[model samples]
Target: MTEEEKKTADTGQQEEAKKPETSAEGTKEQKEEKASADTKPETEKKADGKEEAAAADASAKDDKKASFFKKNDKKEKELQDKIDALNDQLRRQMAEFDNYRKRTDREKEQMFSNGEANVIEKILPVVDNFERGFDTVQDEDKDDAFVKGMQKIYSQLQKELTDLGVKPIDCVGKPFDPSFHNAVQQVEDDTKESGTVAVELQKGYMYHDKVIRHSMVAVVS
Candidate 1:
């Protein structure tokens, strides 16, 4: 063929070879870009998962701490309530014991007073007999040894009775009281007022504030 035609054909063949190489390079670059894009998405997903795990762990720890505090607070409240109840019970017991002690002391005092009154009441007749015996003694026997001894013993008995809180109730020339004197006889007297005690027939005795024996008296009206 001609020289110019041969040169043109050679140039056309070189251009065609260059076009295939260019197309292959473009495909390889596209594949590498797509791979890079995929790796970026995976890395982002891993980072998100790690963050989520860290958040969950922190939440669990906070919940555990809150529950522990709540339990401790409840226990403390229960202990305080128990202590208060025990204190109340102790106070009640102490008050009950004090009341029992006071009651016992009062009962003992009442028993002692009653016993003394009963003994004094029984001995009243003996005391009356002693006074009558003293009245029966003659003037000549007043200086006798036996009479003097009897008089001293009677005086000593009276002094002992006075020391024991025993005293005679006054009935003569006093206003008649049913609580202190019993009227066995009534008399009309112009000198004394009505409902007045003129004479005492039997002696009445008092032990402290209580009457052991009532006075038998004659009332003048």
Candidate 2:
């Protein structure tokens, strides 16, 4: 009803409208802050996931590299083993070949020696006939030029045989040996010991230290 009372009522009404606007502004700021906080947790979770994925990828790559190296090492070892085995086999084959060569050489030498001995044995009979024919010649024939020439030839042949590692074995007046002498007759002799060779009917010959012929002898018993 009064002017003062009417002015107070208008001021009170203006204050009531300002209070509601302030409260609305504070509620909007609170909502904006809550939204910001929620977005921060999502962004941090995404970053952590990326880091975990990168670390897993790096570990997988490292594992693959290790596996590759291991496989290469195994293959190298196998190849080395094969090389060693081949080397051992080659050595064994070479040794076998060497032994075979040595054996062949020995056999060839033995065969040559045997052949030489056999030829010498066959020629010895001709020498014996020459000596026998000379013994049958008359004493007058010894002065003949033809007889002397025959004696020279026989002496030359004997010298050639001596130079060829051939020698005559002496059996008479020595003890009889079955290995060197073949007894053709037995005689009773008081001068020589028993089982002694009294006479040599055929001369024995040796070639290169091996007997080519045994002596035919008469034994004294």
Candidate 3:
């Protein structure tokens, strides 16, 4: 070969070696940049995961607080309802007791009145017998022992009746009142006033200030 052709061939060989080295360096730089970009994306994903976990924990704590408060409020309402029921029951019991007391008092009063009436009714027959014995005795025998005995019995009966809150109505020589006296006969007399009682045929008795029997009387006009 010629000398110039040989020199050109040697230079071309050196350039070929330099070109391979530059190509290898450029490939290594590109690989390093791509690896750096991939690592940055992984770091950002880790930060987002941590934030999501924190938010979930906070939500769980809030739910627990709400549940506790709801349970407490329900218990408080149940307790209040029980208290109100107890108060209503107490009031009803008190009212029942008061009504029972009033009824008992009324029954006691009625029993007392009935007892007094029974005693008075039993003694009325004895009073009637004494009156019949006194009426049978003649007025001319007023000083006789039998007549005096009847008077004594009548006086004793009068005293007994007075002690028992009983009294005789005075109808003779008084104005005739239908409330206290029953007129059996009417007579015209100049010596007496009109509508006045001339004589009492039967004595009237009062028990506890109330009239038990009206006096039988003769009225003069």
lDDT of 3 by residue, 103-167 (tens): 99999977886677567757776787888877787779878987888789878977887887888
User: How many steric clashes between backbone atoms does each model show?
Assistant: 0, 0, 0
Lowest summed lDDT window (length 10), candidate 3: 113-122
Where model 3 places Cα greater than 4 Å from the true spot, the runs are: 1-97, 135-153, 173-175, 191-193
Q: Distance (Å) between predicted and true CA of 207, model 3? A: 2.1
lDDT of each: 0.93, 0.93, 0.86
Worst 10 residues of 1 by lDDT: 116-125
Q: Put down candidate 1 lDDT per residue, 1-221, tens digits, no spaces.
A: 89999999999999999998999999999999999998999999999999999999999999999999999999999999999999999999999999999999999999998998898788888889988998899998889999889888888988988999999998899999999999999999999998999988999989999988899999997
The TM-scores of all predictions, comma-separated, are: 0.70, 0.67, 0.48
TM-score between candidate 1 and the true structure: 0.70
What TM-score number comes out for model 2? 0.67
Error of 1 at 154 (Å): 1.7
**Cα RMSD (Å) per model?**
5.7, 5.4, 8.8
- Candidate 2, residues 77-163, lDDT tens digits: the string is 999999999999999999999999999999998899899888878889999999998999999889999988989999998998898
Q: Tell me how far the alpha carbon of residue 161 in candidate 1 is from the true structure, in angstroms, after superposition.
A: 1.9
